[model samples]
Target: MAVTQFNTEAMEQCRTTVSSQAGQFGAIGDGFSNQYGNPEIFGKLGASGAVSSAVSAMDQAGAQEFEAAEKVLRKVESALDAIQTSVHDVEEANKNSMRAV
Candidate 1:
């Protein structure tokens, strides 16, 4: 395949992965709001029950976001690798074509 074509394909794939991760982060943010919001409710629920639980809940939400970001970053790295490979392939192909000419 041509270098440009390969790069385009890789970029499209990476974009898809990033879009998926953005949605995941959005969900995690929403969950954090629901699980740890409302100071009045937090006070009523008591420390051991809901108040203390917010710590764990927030941690879990942060972990989810981190995982999603990692996933998206990996995809970007993969895309870069693919582009490099494509460039190498095109260079080799050009050398062969020059010999034929």
Candidate 2:
């Protein structure tokens, strides 16, 4: 069998980068709401019918979309977990194989 080289360090770096970025999704989502979706955004002014409905709908959609995105974010975390597990498994397998040689 041909030996395949696994660059553990590169894999680790990629995982670290992706995980660090993924961790920021929550804060970003919250910031969006705080900045744009706050109910007080259009304070002291009368907003009704299509205008109000549109804004409300947009805000709600943003919230729901963010929530759905959070589900995807969780999947990303799970993927990282899976990657870590695979890294460990592969390293162990390589060690065992080396010992057998």
For this target, which candidate reaches the highest lDDT against the unseen true structure? 2
How far residue 23's Cα lies from its native spot in candidate 1, in Å, is: 22
Q: Please list all clashing residue pairs in model 1, or write none if there are none.
A: none
- Global local distance difference test of model 1: 0.64
Q: Quote each prediction's TM-score.
A: 0.52, 0.59
Q: Which portions of model 2 show Cα errors greater than 4 Å?
A: 32-47, 93-101
lDDT (10s digit) by residue, model 2, range 1-101 = 99777676776677676566555665556654633344455675666344656776776677667666766766776786687788789888978888542
lDDT of 2 at 83: 77
**How would you encode candidate 1's per-residue C-alpha lDDT over 1-101 as one tens digit per residue?**
65444455766666666666656666665555544445565556555466556676776778677666766666666676667677778888988888542
Model 1, position 17, has a per-residue lDDT of 66
Reference-based lDDT, residue 89, model 1 = 86
Model 1, total clashes: 0
